[model samples]
Target: MPLHDFRSDTVTLPSPAMMAAIAAARLGDAARGDDPTVADLERCAREITGKDDALFVPSGTMANLAALLAHDCRGGEVIVEEAAHLYNSEGGGLSVVAGAVARPVKGRHGILAPASIEAAIRGSANPAVAPTRLVCLENTHNAAGGTVMPVETMAAIHDVARRAGIPVHLDGARLFNAAAHLEVPIGALCRPVDSLWFALCKGLGGPVGAILAGDAAFMRKARRAVRMLGGGMRQAGLIAAPALVALDDPYPAHRRDHALARRLACGLAAIDARLVDADRVQTNIVNCHVDDADDIARDLGARDVLTLSRGKNRIRFVTHSQVDEASVDAAVDALADILATRPNWSTPCRESLPT
Candidate 1:
C-alpha cells in the first residue's frame, strides 16, 4: 500500500541529518549580514560556483528576479529559451517586477544556441527598441525532460554575450543534477556566466533555500533587491544549516536520481514507445508524451502511484534522493496496469499546451 510519488523533486522531505543540523544551528539576523551560519552557507555557495560572492534567498524565483534587478535590467530585454521555466512558469516576474521584456527564442530541448541568442538581440543600434540587457539559461531544463546543456555550449554563448556587452544569468535549479550527469565540477559549469542561482531544495535535499552568486559588486545590488522583494530574514541560520548539510555531499544522490529517471524512461518505452524517449532523459526528469495523460494520471493515483500531468498530453516524473528503485518499478507497474485497460490511450494527436 506504499505510494510511489513521481510528481517532482520539490516534494522531497528533509533527511534526519538535515533536521539535526537545523536544530543545532547558531542564529543571528541574516538580513543585516550577521548570521554566522548564513555566512557559512553563502561562502560554501560562492566556493561551489567559483563566484566572488553569493547571497542566500528564499526561492529560485527570488534569486533569479534579484539577479535581473541587480543587473539593472529594468525596461530592457532578456533573451531566454522559449521553453525555459523562467519565461513560462515564473509568474511573469521578469516583466511585472523588473519591467524587462522576455525575448523567447526557440532552441532544441531548452538549450539556447549562441546564434539564436545573437539573432534575438535588439535595441543596440536603435534607441526605439528595448536594448538586450541579459541572457538567461536553464540547465537540466525542466520543460525538456531535464536535458543538460553541454559546458562547451555554455562557453560559446558566453563568448557571444561578451562580444555584445551583455551579461548572462543561469537558472540552475537542478545544477547538481547537471554536474553529476556531465561528470564535471560545479564551478566549471558556472564559470562562463555573470550570475547564476541554484536551489538547495530540489535534489539537494534541503527543506528550502536558493543561492544567487556573482561578483561582489553585483551581490551588493542583489542584496538590496532581496530586501525590496521582502526576502530579508532574521535567524535564517535555521534554513542555512540544513542547506549546508545538503551541499556537503549532493552529487552521488543526484547521479542515482538520474539513473532512476532512465529506469523509468526505459520501462515506459518498453510498455509503449510513444510514451517516452529514454535518450532524451538526461537527468532526474522523465517527461512523457501520451495523449491520455489526465486519465492515466488519475488511474495511476487511484493505484497509489502519484504523478504530475504537466499539460494536456504531458506527464512529468522526477526522481529525487528520497525515491528508490522500488518506487520507480512500482510506478512503471501501475502505469502498465492502467495502459492494459485502455489500449488506445496513446493514439497520435496534435500536441497543444495544457489548458
Candidate 2:
C-alpha cells in the first residue's frame, strides 16, 4: 500500500484499453455531426439509457447546464433534494447560466419523499410565486454518503412531477454504481425521467466526458444549448473514443468499487462504531464522522492515506479502480492508530451533517 488516493473517483487514471482506443480513433468534426466515433458513443449512450437521442459533453456539470437551458425553464423554479450535487456543487450554474432558481427540500438520507416535493411545487397563479418547471434527482446521491435512491422511489417522484406537469432531470454522475447496487439494467432507471446525464469518468473509469440523453426534440435543443455554452469540441472523438472503452463493461468495475467501499466502511466501523454507519454505504463512497475532521484528514495524509474532510466532522473516502484490498486495510489501520493515539478522540460529533 504505497499511498491510497481516496479523494475522489475522478482521480482514476484511464485504462489501457481506453488509451489504445484514443490512439486508434477515427475522427471528424463533432459540432457538425460528422465524427463517427463520437456518433458511436452517443448511439451507445442512447441505447443504454433508452433515450431517443444523446449528446456527449465535456463534463457532467455542462451536461446538466445544457439540460436546464434546453428545458426552457428560464425565470422558473427547480426543485431538488437539499443535499443534491446540483444545489451544493456545480458552482450555481442553474442560476448564473440557465436563470432558474433552486428550491431545496429536505430528504431522508438523500432519498426524497414525494409529499415533500408536492408541498414545494408552486404555480404561476400568484405573481410572487415562481412556477416549478423541473425536478432534479440524483441516484447514488453524493452528500448522503453515496446512499442510493431506489427505482420505486424514483417512479414515485416522477409520478408526483408528472401530476404537476413538471419535467424530471436526473444528475446521475454515478449512475453505473447505482445500477450495479440495484442489480438492474441502466435503462430501467432512465425510463421514468424526461432526461438525464451520466458521467463516463467516475467509477466507469474513463479519462473524461459524460453523456446527456433525452427525447429527439429535447436533444436538438440541448445541442444548441451546448454550443451556446461554448462546449463544442471539433474532434471530440478524442474524448468519446475512451468513453466507449469505459462502456465496454462498466458494471464489473462499479461492483468492484462498491465492494471496496463496503470494506472500507465496515473496517472504519470496527475501529469505532460511531465513526461510520457501514450499512449506509450503497456504492463507492465511504463517509465517516470524526471529531476535528480537518485535523484527522491532515494526520491521515501525513501517514500516506489521502482522504477529504468535509466540514467539521465528515470525511469522505471514495474507492475507485486505483485502490485494492491492501490500500483499504492500510487506511483502516491508519485511522485506528490515529484514534488510539489522540487524547480527545472520543468526543462525539457535535454538529449536524447535512445531506
Candidate 3:
C-alpha cells in the first residue's frame, strides 16, 4: 500500500504543469529586477492580494520577517495572537531581527477580539513603554486547527489599528485555503490589511518561496529588509515560474483538499467522536485530540500513515494536492486499527476537549 502522508501541506511535490512552466521560464538577475518570470510572479501576486506592490522571498518566515522589519524599523511592539505562528513558530525573528517586541493577546480560535487589540495598543504619551507599531493576524491559523479569521473580524481589527495609526500585517501563509473555505476572491480577504504574505510552498504546491504584498513604499523598505537578511536571489525564475502557476488557479486544488479533510474528520469522528470536532474541520487541517498522541503518531508512522503530534494529546493532519479521498480514508482506517489494538485507549469525555 502507498504511504499516506498527512503531516503537512508543505510536503506536496510540484505538479507536471509547474515543472513545465519552470523549464520554459525566462530568467535574469532577480536582484537587478531583470528576471521576467519573477516580475510576472510579483505582478500576479499584487493583483491577487490587491496590493500596489509585491516581493518574492525565499520562505514564509522571511516574507513575514521582511514585512515586520519594514513596518517596525525601531525597537517597538507588535500585537499578535498568543498562539500565532509569528509568536510561537518563527523562532523570535520579529524580536531579534526586526527589533520589535511581541505583545501576545489571547484569541478565540485564533480570531483576535477587537477589544483585546485596542487594549494592547500602547499610548504614545508613555515614553517608557514600547509603542505598538504593528498588528499581526494569521489566516487559517495553524495552531488553532486551521481556523479562518473572517473578513469582518479582520476589518474590525484594521479599524482599531487605523485609528491608532498603526499598520496591520497578515501572516497569510494559508491565505488561499482560507479563501477557498469562504468561497470568496482572495482580494476580498486581503482588503483589510496594510500588508500581507502568503506561502507558495504550502497548499499552493510550489517547491519553495513566498510572496509579501503591500504598497510600493512598504515594499521599497521591505526590499531593503530582504537584502539585509540575505534573501536576494539571482536567476529566481526557476522557482518563481512554478509559484506563478500555483497562484494562477489554486482554488480548485485547495477546495479538493478541504473536502478530503472533511472526509478524514468524518472518518475519525466515526471511530471516536471525542477525537475531533468534525464541524471545526475547516480548510485542509484536521486537529484531533487523541490519547497519548505521540505514541499514536509513532504507531501510525510505522503503518505508513504519517501524522504530526502537536502536543501531549493533540495531533494535526493536513490534506494537500498530493493527498486524495482514498488516501484520507486509508489513513482513517489505519488510525482506527491502531487505536483498537491499544488496550489502554479510551475516548475522553466530550467536555474535556478544547473549545
In terms of lDDT, which candidate is strongest? 2
> Candidate 3, residues 1-355: lDDT per residue as tens digits?
8989999999988899999998999999999899999999998988888899999999989988899888864678989998899988889888888888899998887789999999999966888999999999999899888899999999999999999999999999999999999999889988999999999999999999999999889998999999889999999999999998888878998999999999999999999877888998888999888878899899989888899997778888999988888888888888899889976777654443434
TM-score of each: 0.97, 0.98, 0.97
lDDT of 1 by residue, 250-305 (tens): 88889889999999999999999878878888899998777767877898899888
What TM-score does model 1 achieve against the real structure? 0.97
Q: What is the total number of backbone clashes in candidate 3?
A: 0
Q: How much lDDT does each candidate structure score?
A: 0.89, 0.91, 0.90
Please give, for residues 1-355, the per-residue lDDT of candidate 2 as tens digits: 3889999999988788888999999999999989999999999998999999998999999999999999987999999999899989899999999999999999999999899999999998999888999999999899998888899989999999999999999999999999999999899999989999999989888888899999988889999999999989889898899999989878998899999999999999998888888888999999899888899999999889999998888899999999999999999999998999985776555447754
**Rank order (by TM-score, best first):** 2, 1, 3
lDDT of 2: 0.91
Q: List the residue pairs that clash in candidate 1.
A: none
What's the distance in Å from true for residue 62, model 1? 0.3
Q: How many clashing pairs does model 2 include?
A: 0
